[model samples]
Target: MTQTVMHLDDTDSLERFDAALDALEGHLKRVFADDSAEADRAVLAALQEQVRVLTEERDRLLTDLEAERARVQRLKEANEEVSGRLEGVMGALKDMAPALQD
Candidate 1:
């Protein structure tokens, strides 16, 4: 039996996630200080755009994760099939050894 391990390095994603949070925070601060209607609308638009970008990034990461999981599953199934075949061959060789000793 062989073991398969997966390591995920998500530094870039984490950085992006952090940046999005910071942008949202900054937008909130601006919204609180700006009293004019136009300024408020502009801030709201910026916030909405940030949300859209973050949502897209989240979706992309989820898709990538699902794909990786499927790949790992396929690899595991292939490994099991190969292991079973090897064991069958070894058993057959063992069975033939006694007859050859005659």
Candidate 2:
């Protein structure tokens, strides 16, 4: 048994996919140059639908990525604020410690 893994960052795979799509499109054009075959039209329609679905998915992923980035930025800001407050409290405690020792 063999398992295959794909990564989003695999540019070579993406390039190959694109090349394959291009080749398929060229072949279809040559086969259906007369534009009268119902089967060819159906295949082209299916391909276009697939492209639309992929485009929608890409848009959704981009939107999700932007939202995640915004959330991360907000979390970083909150962490910094908490850290500053903690430092201030520590400083106040240190000041009171010296007074108590006296």
Candidate 1 lDDT tens digits, 1-102? 995665756556656776876787677667757776465567677877877787687778767767877887999999999999999999999999999999
Clashing pairs for model 1 are none
Best by lDDT: 1
Number of clashing pairs, model 1? 0
RMSD of each: 6.6, 7.3
Q: Model-by-model lDDT, in order?
A: 0.77, 0.71
After superposition, which runs of candidate 1 have C-alpha atoms over 4 Å from their true positions? 1-44
Candidate 2 off by > 4 Å: 1-39
lDDT of 2 by residue, 1-102 (tens): 994543455346445656666676676566667566667567777876776676565566667657766876999999999999999999999989989999
Q: How many backbone clashes does every candidate have?
A: 0, 0
lDDT score at residue 23, model 1, on the 0-100 scale: 81
